[model samples]
Target: MQYSVLGTTGVKVSKICLGTATFGVAPTAQDADRIVGAAIDLGINFVDTADVYGNMPVFDRPGAPAAADREPAEQILGRTLRGRRDRMVIATKSNGIVGLDINDRGLSRRHVIRQVETSLRRLETDYIDLYYAHDPDPDTPMEQTLAAYDDLIRQGKIRYVGLSNHPAWQVTHALWIADDRRQQAPVAAQVKYNLIDRSAERELGPACDRFGLSIIPYAPLHGGLLADLRVLDREVSGDQRFQGSGFSESEIATAREVERLSRAWGLAPYQTSLAWLLSRPAVASAIVGAETVDELHANATAADVELEPAQLASLTALADQPPAFQHRAGDGPERPPATTSSDPTA
Candidate 1:
């Protein structure tokens, strides 16, 4: 595995960050152990989990077996990471539905602080290397959230602040406040960025560039659509990973073409898709999740795949064509050609 500095954070992490959404959702405790063990064995030291990523939700459904444990992802990681926590950068998020209580969710001052404590307890770690606001909370003031994060930093509860599923304008405003208020600035952001959805490139991409923040894209494979377009035939429309969205016929065809094009380039569709994503500017890491070590290894090894300039340009040109639905596109800087600085660290 190749390592890259996580956006402005001095700490270096693997290009392929291991996402733990599958911990209790898919894999058994033994399976989770092997997957994490395989990741560490492969030099992937970045592991991402969420406070809400428990067995409560499985395969996009909310009805997990009552016998399953809560916060299984973190609990499992805490158990599996014994004597090895120092070697990895552990990231987890809050602001999602973790309970039925009124204060169980959101990025409010009370919730952020409360959730971090719970997260720390579950992970069996005192300090989170990176803690993210899972999503924006319109109910709470941004200042309240930022101030809470500031407190966490001072207390050494978390080292870096990041956000996910935030709009570009909101992120920009938060950055401005952090700088003007003299608070610890956010070091990274996450968004749904993939070959099929370049919407993030329009605003979040450029915004991160201006703020010197890293963009960690989740769902690089569009929740298995790009992994294998054939999965679409299964008709499992509500796979939670797709975020309540499904690909159109045209989108499927486009994904198929991308997969076919990859073989001509001597790579799997997933590998080619990941390589293209990693080559883009502003990307610090691509978070991929899997139930088994073999599946994880297939996606993680894309770090070794590189496309020639011409091949990359060809792929970009193909993607430039409008997709089935009006995919989000807006004014922003053009993505620079892939280069050595894709994950540059100082």
Candidate 2:
């Protein structure tokens, strides 16, 4: 498998990150073991999970058919990575906002501190390679967030930090806070980027490029849209992704066009889509979720399939239309202010 540097953190990550969102859910721990084994066999050294990954709370109730309230995925991950934790770069996320109370949800110092210990205990690891704030905390100030991350880094709880589903401006501000506070800054950003969803192309890509932050794109297959050929016919198979995505008819046509290009290029649609994502220098890793061992094998093998320039161009032309807000985020640029009382530079 091919590897890439995870932003400024200097960690060499596999181009395809193994996503465990499907782990320990629907499928048992044994099924997860098989998938993990396949990923490792393919030389995938990066694994991504979250504190609330498998806790599928249906109908807005906390009591879902999950393994447990906390430490479910981590326990399985630790058990699976018995002799290979050092060789792999492990990452997990927090701030899922499941509870009804306010303190249970944001990137506050208390929440971060509370969760870090819990995660460490669950994973049975001393330090996490990467810890991400799963979502933006609108109520918490940037300085407070940075301060919490700073403490974690100082205490050696988390080695590196990242943000997911956050806007470019928020990342910019977070970095500014890290700079001013003389703390560890987030070296990566995660967003939904794939053949079906190129929304990150406009703002996130450019912002990460400017800030020296790497992009770890999740939903790399548009939630099985490009992977499953049935999506070409504008039909979804009872997946939550379809319920929330609100994909338009035009988007469906574009996906079919992408499928057509895949045929012309003599590659699978998922392979072409992943290869296209790998073509971008800003993307460090593409997180792929696979439910079964066979699916994991198929998705992991896409890294070996390289597309020619002509093929890349054809695929781009087929599905490169920018959305309504592409130029807005790119055009409005700002330098975040320093966040300390005593400025270092005179």
Candidate 3:
């Protein structure tokens, strides 16, 4: 497997990170054990999970059980990594409602501190390699949130800090706060970046480049849309992400184009998609989840598939274009009031 430096940190991580969002949900605990074991054999050293990932149905169903009542992904991972904890760079997040208490969510000092303790216990680990604020909390002051992270680092609870699902402005603001306070700054940013959605390239890409942060992109396959375009033609079964209505026509067309290009290049659709993402600027790793050992083996091969410059450009051009927004008339440089001054010098 190819390895890269995580942001400006000296730590080396595998190009592919094993995502555990589906653990104990789609795949049972036994299935997770095999999948994780396969990832280790494939040389993947990074795993990403969260406190609220194991019980995803609760968010969709109104009367579903509370998240705390379900077995979280962290606990499943803990059992799976009993003898092999040191072999992976573990990353998890907080800021989601995991309990019924009013103080159970957000990036407040209380929530952050409480969740870290719970996560450590569930993961059976002394220190988490990276901890993320899963989402931005507008109610809590950034200073309070950052200060809590700084304190955690000093106490050796988490080695590094990261942010997920936060805008570019908020990311830069957090960095500024860390710099001004001499606290532990974030080294990575996680977002839903994939072949189908290239929105992160608009601002987060540049922000990460300027601030020395690595982009760890999740959903690199766009919920299996890029993996196989044929799913659009057939009736998709068992996959909750595409059960009700499936993808939009435009989305399907985009995936079909990606498939055509992959065939022309003599590569599988998934390999082509993942290779293109790994080649993008500021991207350190792409997180992929698998339901079985065979699937994990297939996805891990993308780490070694290097695309040619032309191939990379083709996939980039096929990505969904960002929505257009007209700039206000006065936003740009004025035309010098119709250039009434005749002199070129004027």
Candidate 4:
């Protein structure tokens, strides 16, 4: 497997990270064991999960299953990594509904502190390699959250901080806050980026590039739309993203074109998809999920597939379209330059 440094950190992680979002739901506990074992055998040392994963029923939905009946993804992962926990760069997140209490969620100091302890116990680990604020918490001031993360870093509870599902402005704000406070800042970002979704490139990509933050893209397959070309001809059921609504017509058409290109290049659809994502700027790794051991092996091999420059260009042109505003004949007015001071928050 290939490896890359996570942002500016000295530590290296596999280009393909094993995602455990489907751990307790699609794949049984036994299946998880085999899949994780195979991932390690294939040289994948990075794993990503969230406290809210594990296919649990909605905490607030009426008629939902009792809290005791839930099976958190962390618990399943903890059991699977009994003796090999130290061999992986494990990442988990907070700011998700883990209980029915009003204070059970958000990036508040109380929630972050309480959840870190809960995650440690569930994962059977003393410290988390990377901890993320899963989503933005507008109610809680950014300083309060960063202060909590800084304290955790000083305590050695987490090695690094990351942000997920946050807007470009918020990401920069957090970085500025950390810099101003002389606290540890986030070194990476986890977002939904793939062949079908290039939205991250709009502003998030440039922000990460300028701030030295690595982009660890999840859902690289677009909910399996790019995994296999055959899904086009068959019915898609039980899919987490496209189960009920189904894929849009344009999305299917794009997948079909990708399939044709993959055939011409003599490569699997997933390999082509993953290679293209890895080639993007500021991307440190792509998180891929699998239901079985064989599936994991197949996805893991993408780390070695390298596309030709011409091939990469063609695939990129398929999805990376410029904004409509840029199509105008005349150039738009120039914008003001960003802050040049050492403290961007100033």
Clashes of each: 0, 0, 0, 0
Question: Cα deviation in Å at residue 214, candidate 4?
Answer: 0.7
C-alpha RMSD of candidate 3: 8.5
| TM per candidate | 0.87, 0.86, 0.88, 0.89
Q: In model 4, what are the clashing residue pairs, if there are any?
A: none
Better of 1 and 2 by TM-score: 1
Give lDDT tens digits, candidate 3, residues 191-291. Answer: 98888778788888899999999999988988788887655554432134423345777777888898899899898898999999999889999998776
lDDT of 2 at 236: 32
What stretches of model 2 exceed 4 Å from their correct place? 58-71, 98-100, 231-247, 324-346
What digit string (tens of lDDT, one per residue) describes model 4 on residues 221-337? 887788785655544322432223557777778788888999899888888999999999899999987767877888888899999999998888888463321211222332322
Q: How accurate locally is residue 339 in candidate 4, as Cα lDDT from 0 to 100?
A: 45
TM-score for candidate 1, please give it.
Answer: 0.87
Clashes of 3: 0
lDDT of 2 by residue, 197-246 (tens): 67887777899998889999988877776775675454332245322444
Find the 10 residues in a row with the least total lDDT in model 4: 322-331
Which segments of model 1 are wrong by more than 4 Å?
Answer: 58-71, 233-246, 320-346
Evaluate model 3: give its TM-score. Answer: 0.88
